[model samples]
Target: MLKFTQNKTPKLNFKKALKKPIPVKCVQIDEPFEVETMEGVMKGKAGDWLMIGVNDEKYVCDASIFKKTYELMK
Candidate 1:
């Protein structure tokens, strides 16, 4: 015979969670962005963000999207 167990953890409120201020780091894009050669596709600026390539290739993205993504990464 076997016994069964149940989880009683409460569900988190995501909407309320987002209300808190998130801490992030400030970084500058030092070079021209290449879209094709990037890995770990993180968020971008405006519409595009930035990515660090597996082979040391860096890219720049739109401002809005990058801000959003940068916050998440922070």
Candidate 2:
């Protein structure tokens, strides 16, 4: 049988973890883009950029894009 014992030294430094900053990248959108939606489809206009979500899971797009797409559907 093996017995487990706690180490006298602490495992991690809390100070270092707090000082670290999360990594993120800023992307620029220069042209119109399109996205699919449950209702139908959506679009993004040129000259519009968004502070996208981490790992490209989400993003901010131009308001006009959504408006145009809705109008077209109607």
Candidate 3:
């Protein structure tokens, strides 16, 4: 008798939307934003995304929300 082994597909991890940081002209806060840093809650606006440091720490917010709120920094 011959036996066949079942193939299993790898599971996907969606815990984090953005695994790495991308370049953004800046984060325009139409209203206001409060971001938490390793040190504590740091705030600011304008400049590169990675440099913005808003996403440096773990966050559960959807970036698309910001995309809808803010246009390309240009």
The residue-by-residue lDDT of candidate 1 on 1-74, one tens digit each, is: 75445765445554533444544333455544445434554444344445553455666646666666555552
lDDT of each: 0.50, 0.49, 0.45
Which 10 consecutive residues of model 2 have the lowest summed lDDT? 65-74
> Which residue pairs clash in candidate 3?
none
Better of 1 and 3 by TM-score: 1
Give the total clashing residue pairs for model 3: 0
Over the stretch 1-74, how does candidate 3's per-residue lDDT look in tens digits? 85545695346564756445454344434444566656677554433132343455522223565555445534
Instruction: Give the winner by lDDT.
Output: 1
Q: Point out where model 3 deviates above 4 Å.
A: 1-26, 45-55, 58-74
Measured against the true structure, the TM-scores of the candidates, in listed sequence, are: 0.26, 0.31, 0.25
What is the Å distance of residue 44 in model 1 from its true position?
Answer: 11
Candidate 3 has a TM-score of: 0.25
Report the CA-based lDDT of candidate 2 relative to the real structure: 0.49
Error of 1 at 68 (Å): 1.4
